[model samples]
Target: MSTTPTSTLRFCLRQWSAWAPGLETREAWSGWDGTLPHGDASPKVDAMPAMLRRRADRLGKMTLETLYAPDIAYHGQPLIHASRHGEATRTVPLLQALARDGAVSPQAFSMAVHNATAGLFTIATRTHAPVTAIAAGPETALAGLLEACSQLADGAASVLLCFSDEPLPALYQPYADTAEAPFALTLDLVAGDDFTLGTGAACTEDATPLSLLHFLLGGETALPLSIRGGWQIVRSAM
Candidate 1:
């Protein structure tokens, strides 16, 4: 009973790379921090504020302060924040502490939530606009994009879709071996555009996580595609 978006949205992609250990830097397609190679080179626990600034730098000429400033010209758009593995690195330590002492640091618990990045973004940008956080396993990226498209269809002027994922702890390394990279994309709907929505069907079978991810990033495909139980597929800009 839902209607599709009549107009398409505009989007841009950003990524962080080389921040995970045991993973080659070439595997990363986004932010490329040199921390992975050095075992003891973890960014300071309180360096998130500065890291956000550095990540925001990829936007070119746009600073975190300017993007999140109160008087900025955001025009009240919606947001979809995505992270397949949200702050896993930060949570591991807290989990270890709780396992040993039956109590955890309140700050660490709060900071490990899936929406932590979104909260920080809101605080830094000083924007009270609607925001949604999604953690859809490997499909986090597509899920976030779909939500952004939904907002645009519902008449939102714009939507900022951000995705980030850090490396897991050594104990959880068996789950995935991908490099640490955070990718973010900001999308805005506009009328009278030359691009057209792609078409495809999503089905759940035995597709690799990276394959699905590549499909989303490749663009220029049809929708209605089947996605696995934990995965999602949606149209993207060309």
Candidate 2:
């Protein structure tokens, strides 16, 4: 009856940033008590170009806000963007328009893809490095972390791993298996011994993007993430 994880991954966390309604500051997030705030307010995107900001949806704005946070010094490292539902707001509307009127705005169609926000981020920052988009249902964050570690193992110096998602549109709310709120979090990961990832028993809590943030901020020894069969990240004892 051994339940300990057999496989493990170790990595360093250089810098981190997170954004959500009423929890935009490090102080606010540090005091988070597992309660999510309700709001339509999205993160500010003034750092992005006017054109890019104008074209970006709410999720895109959140991504830009977290990525370009003044607190973190992001210098165009390779990026891994993960989301459970990418561009659902835009994609859902496009699908509805297509079904109802047989017409979809070309602009909307272009931005409906999962990589649209990633593309926008790179364009805004003028980062020519590789950017990978990941959508692995509930395992999106885990997948993004693995991808970042893989790149580090392949000789990259650093990688920016960002997890961003929002509540699905009202049309798909009924199909939602778990409640979600709008949030974006980024961790600048490098090669070091800051944390370890491994498998464990399933978790019953709401394992949304914010959960990862809480785990990192709360100083927990291990976070039992409800991902894949089950996965967890343990802060390194070193």
lDDT of 2 by residue, 128-162 (tens): 87989999887676778778888887888889999
Error of 1 at 207 (Å): 8.9
> TM-score for all predictions?
0.58, 0.91
Residue 63, model 2, lDDT? 87
Q: Please name the candidate that would achieve the greatest lDDT relative to the true structure.
A: 2
Against the unseen true structure, what C-alpha lDDT does each candidate score? 0.47, 0.81
Off by over 4 Å in 1: 1-76, 177-226, 229-238
